[model samples]
Structure formats: C-alpha cells, structure tokens
Target: MMVDVLYLTAAVCFIFALGGLSRAESAQRGNLCGIFGMAIACVAAYLSVNSADFWFILIAIVMGGGIGVFIARAVSMTALPQMVAGFHSLVGLAAVLISFSACFAPELFRISTPSGIKVLSLLEMGLGSTIGSVTFIGSLIAFLKLQGIYKGHSIPLPLNAFFASSICCLLFYFTVTESEEAFLLLTMISLLFGATLIMPVGGADMPVVVSMLNSYSGWATSGIGFTIGNHLLIITGALVGSSGAILSYIMCRGMNRSLWSVIFAPEQAKANDAVASGGTRAFKSGAPEDAAFILKNANSVIVVPGYGMATSKAQYALKELGDMLKKDGISVKYAIHPVAGRMPGHMNVLLAEADVRYDDVFELEEINRDFSSCDVAYVVGANDVVNPAAKNDPSCSIYGMPILEAEKAKIILFLKRSMGTGYAGIDNELFYASNTMVLLGDAKKTTEDIIKAMRE
Candidate 1:
C-alpha cells in the first residue's frame, strides 16, 4: 500500500517535471523534479523487491550512476545529441534484457501456466523484444552518425521493407506457437531491421530520427511493463512514447519535412548531396576587424547561431558581444532556426548557458522578416539555417525549409571554420551574396577578436 502511494507520487512529480521542462525558465526546476521523482520510484521499487536481490540492485544502481555522472561531466554541448542517443539505446537494451529474464523465468513474473507460458505474456514479450532490439541498434547507428563516424552516410538495402515485414510476420508466428526460439530470433531479425531502417536515412533527418527512436524505446518498455504487470512502468512508458512522437512530428515540421518522407523516403534527403560536390564557389572574406566595424556602426543586429557555435563553445563570448552592442544603443536580437544544430533546441541550450536574456531571442518566424530592415546580421558558426538556397534553389533537398532571412540584412558578417557546406552537404548561396563577409577562423576565437576590436 505504501509502495502504491510512492508510485503515485512519483507519477505526479513526473507530470510536473515535464511541464516545467517545456519552457527554458523552469528547466532547472524540471530537472530537479525529475530527479526527485525517480528517487522516490527507486526507493519504492527497492522496498518491493526480495531481500536476496537488494545487494545486486544496489550495486547495479551505483555502477550505472557513477558512469552516468562521469559521462555527463565529460561530454560537451556539441556532442549532446549522440550522448542522448547512446543513453536511449541503454533503455532499449534494458527492456530487451528484462524480457529475456521474464521469458526464462515466467513463474517469477506470474505468467507461467500448467502447460506453458501464458499466450498473452508471450505476445507482450515478443512485441517488447522486437521494439527493444530495433531501438537499441537504431540508436547506436544514430549515435554513430551524429558523432561523425559515418558522415551521415546510410547503407542502402533495396529489399528493406519486404524483409522487415517478413521478419515481423515470422516473429508473430513464433510467439503464437509459444516457442522458446522466438526471443532469440526476434532479437536477431529486429536488429537487422533496425540497421536497415536507419541506414537509409540521411544526416539531415537525424534529429527526427533520434526522437522517433526515443519513442520506440518507450513503447518497448511499455510492452514489457504489461508483461510484468507494472502499472507505473506502463504509465511512464506511455508518457515518454507519446511525448517523443509528438516532438518528432514537431521537428519534422520545423524542417519542412513530412514525417513520412523522412521515414520512408530518405532518398529525397540523400538527393541533397548530389549537387553538393561542386568546385569551390567564389565568395568574399572578411577579418574580425571588418566585422567589428560593421557591428559597431549598425543600428540593429540579429545574431544567428548553429552547430559551429556549439563546437567552438562561443556562447559566453557571444553573450558579451550582444551585451556590448545593446549598451551602445543598438537593437540586439537572436534568431534561432528550429533545425539549426544537431538536436532540437541545441542553440537555445548553449545561449541560455551563457546567460543570454530570454527576451532578446526569437525563433526563425519571429525574427526572419526583421532581418530585411536590420543593419547587420551576425551569423556565428551557422550555415544551412540561413542559407538562401532553401528559398532560391527549388531543386535542392532543403528548398522548402523555412530559413532566417539573414541574407536580407544590410550587411552580413558570417563567422565559421571555413567556407565549406553544412551537414546537409549543400553550398549556402548566402555565402556569396553581395552583402556577406565570411570570417574564417575558430568561432570562439573570432568572436573574442571581434569583442576586442569593439572595445578598442
């Protein structure tokens, strides 16, 4: 009875945590609420378990917690996406392993009958194992891509759909037959399906892919929850699954991509790279001093950030620059593209860390038109999000994607490592625009130099 109350409390805390996490202002509180809720849930779970398992569970928790803390401290903001993917994979693997334990010891889960394991249990375990296996391998592949291990390249298997369907059918058949072989076969084939599903997807859709995999992991957990008769697990899993799915859809819309197109027709995304291999395009270059001069003289400035900013960890210096300009009677605003970085809200996280004022930041739609009337658009370590090709090149993959109209500003000061294309592997026409001046260097170094120039 006490356990029930604790579970209920944990569930309520989770609800509040999700609500808090939706907005940046309450994000820290949300994290705390989540941590508190999990602690309550863990204590209740420990109490419910047998004495024999107490030491084992405690040891496992300590080891896992130690590893998690170490990784959280070591990983940079730029690598957060891959790290998230890796963590999601662990959830999936946990689900699969739990399903195995239940299958081998059906009596422990109270699903075994006089003749054999309950048919319903078999079905639940089958579904759980299948989804879990897929989520595990799929997330690993996503992590690899986000880590630049594969450069977003996908392995093409023309018969992927047919093979995946066939495996599912076989899995269902084996589950109905109540064969012990189902678990192993399900894991093996689903892993293959996982690889095939993600391999065809281009790098452009990785954010959505990560969200979808998260959803898969959640559903896998829910299926196992049903098998184990854990109501709290079911509730938590449903929350994660539904929320992840919604987030995925939202991100797809942000990229102007249909969810179906991103999932079933990765060829469209791959097509973006075909014309990206052209020779070096002519573009004008500028030093930090040139950018500093334009920034000082500008009446209004819009800052656009991307993955490069995260790579250089330039958010602190960037905020300093914004503060300086704002104090000099210049209107300083931040423009964020939804798909600007490797994951959703990547730029916002960095900027927030640097203590940028919330009121000064605006989304692509909010600040895009303002660029036309602006004095200077300061693009820091961003490329595709502000690319004019999305608007001008109809034949390109990202043609329909909405972009920040930094190109429309009176002057464009673009800072990046080089003149190369972004992850989408397409040239940004904004680079060669008449008003644009590309500043080539480390983003943090360039921004610091610009700050020094401004102070002089």
Candidate 2:
C-alpha cells in the first residue's frame, strides 16, 4: 500500500513536471519536479525488490549517478546534441539489459506462471528486446554522426527496407514459436536494421532523427516496464514517448518535410545538387567599421543566430552588442528560427548562457513579420534560415521552409566566415540581395570588432 501510494505521488509529480516544461519560466521548476519524482520512484522500486538485489542496485545507482553528474558538468553547449544522443543510447542499452536478464532468470522476474511462461510476458520480452536493440544501435549511429566520426551522408544498401521487413517478420515468427535461438537472431538483426535505418539520414535532419530516436527509446523503456510490471516506468516512459513524438512532428513541420521523407529519403544529394546548380552571384562586402556605422544609424535591429554562432562561442559577444544598441535607444530583438541550430532550443540555450534578456528574444512566428519593418536584420553565422532559396527554389531540399524574412529588411548585415554554404549545402540568395552587406570573419571576433568601431 505504501509503495502504491509513492508510485501515485511520483506520477502526479511527473505530470506537473511536464506541464512546467512547456514554458521557459517554469522550466527549472519542471526539472526539480522531475528529479523529486525520480527520487521517490527509485526509493519505492528499491524497497519493493528482494534483499539479494539491494547491494547490486545500490552500486549501480552510485556509479551511474556519478557518471551522469560528471558528463553534465563537463559537456559543452555545442556538444549537447551529441550528449543527448549518447544518453538516449544508454537508455536503450538499459532496456536491452533488463530484457536479457528477464530472459535468463524468468523466475527472478516473476514472469513464469503455474502454466509455464506467460505468453504476455514472453511477448513483452520480445518486443522490449527488439526495440531496445534497435534504439541502442541507431542512437550510437546518431551520436557518431553528430560527433563528426561518421560523415553526414546516406549510405544506401539495395533492398534495405525489404531486408528490414523480413527481419521483423522472422522476429515475430520466432517470438510466437518461443525459440530462444531465434530470439537471439532477432536481436542481432534488429541491431543491423537500426544501423541501416539511421545510416541513410543526413546531418541536416539530425534534429528530427534525434527526437525520433528518443521516442524509440521511450517506447523501448515502456516495453521493459510492462515486462517488469513497474507502473512508474510505464508512466514515465509514456510521457517521454509522447513528448518526443510531438517534438519530432513539430520539427518535421518546421522543415516543411513529411516525417516519412525525414526517415527514408536521402537529403545530402539534394542539397549538393542545389549548390552545384546555383551559379555564383556577386555581393557587396563590408568591414566591421561599415557595419558599425549602419547599425548605429538604424532605428531597429533584429539579430539572427545559427549553429555557427554556437560553434564559434559568440553568444556572449553578440549579447554585448545587443546591449550596447539597446543603451543607444535602438529597438533590438532576437529572431530565432525553429530549426536554427543542431538541436531544438540550441540558440536559446546559448543566448541564455550569455544572460540575454528573455523578453528580447522571439521565435520565428513571433518576430518574422517584424523583420521587414526593421531598419537592420543582423545575421550572425546563419545561412539557411535567412536564405531566399528556401522560398524561391522549389528544387532545393529546404524549399518551402519558412525563413526569418531577413531579405525583407531595409538593410541586411551578415557576419560570416566566407561564402561557404550552410548545413543544407545550399547557396544563400540573401547574400546577393541588393540591401545586404557581408562581414566575413569569426563571429565572436567580428562582433567585438564592430563593438570597438561603434565606440570609436
């Protein structure tokens, strides 16, 4: 009765935590709620288990928590996406491990009934193992790609989908037949299928892929939860799965691509084609002094940042410039695209780290229209989000994705490294716009130079 009450309390906390996560103001509270709920759930689970398992569980908890803390403290903001992928892989692996343990010690897991092993328990073990195996391998691939160990291009195998389908069918057949050997075969094949599934995805769509993999991990956890008869795991897994699925759908819609295309279609070739076919177009270049003068005279400015800004660690300098402009009585705001960086809320996280004001930042839908009326649209290390190609070129992979309307601004100032294309590998037509001026250099240094010039 006490364990049941604790579980119910944990569930309530988790529900509130999710609600708190919906807005930035409550995000910290949400995190606290989640942590508290997890603590209670852990205690409940530990108490419910046998004395023989206590020491093992305690050791595992200490090791895992210490490692988690170390990683959380050491990881940089730019590598957060890779870290998230790695963590998802860990969750997958845990599910797989749980399934394996259940298989090896069905008595310990209470899976065997008076009439041999329960069919439902066997089904849960099969599904849990398959999904967990797939998620583990798939998340590893995603981590490698995000970490630059694997090239972000599709590696296609002929009849890959057909082979994956055949594997699934075999796995189902073996599960129904209760063949242990076939179950092992199913696990191996699922791992291969997972690898193949993610190998075809390009880097540009990694955000969606990560979210999809997160959903897979959640479902795998839920399967394991059912196998273990753990209510807390079931509830938490459902929440995570639903949230990840929603995020994936939102990201897919933001890119103006279907979820099917994101998963199956190769995008690297399309991006390369867009770049190759786009002929060189001339554009005006300017120095930091020139940009300073333009910015000083402007009545309003909208700053747009991208993955490059994160890579260059320029958010601090960028915030300084915005603060300077604000002191001069100019209207300054940040225009954040839905898919601006490597992960969801990447730009926001960076800016927040730099102590940028919450009210000054606005999402794509909120600040997109204001760009046209603004005196200057200052782009820092962003390309595709401001690229007119997304709007004008139907053949481009990123076509039909809504942009920041930077081209609509009276004057556009772009701080970039070179004429190099973005992650999408498409030429930015906004660079060639008559009202745009390019400031080529490292984003942090350039912003600092502009600030110095403004003071001079």
List of clashing residue pairs for candidate 1: none
Q: After superposition, how far is residue 384 of candidate 1 from its true place, in Å?
A: 1.7
lDDT (Cα, tens digit) per residue for candidate 2, span 297-416: 999999999888988999999999999999999999999988888778889999999999999999999998898799999999888888888888888778899888999899999999
For candidate 1, lDDT tens digit of each residue in 68-156?
99999999877889999999899989988998998889988889989998888888888888888889989998998888786544545
Cα misplacement distance, residue 270 of candidate 1 (Å) = 4.4
TM-score for each model: 0.94, 0.96
Question: Model 1 reaches what TM-score against the true structure?
Answer: 0.94
Model 1 lDDT vs. the true structure? Answer: 0.85
Q: Once superposed on the true structure, which residue ranges of model 1 sit more than 4 Å away at CA?
A: 269-272
Q: What is the clash tally of candidate 1? A: 0
Alpha-carbon local distance difference test for all models: 0.85, 0.86
Model 2 stretches with alpha carbons more than 4 Å out: 268-279
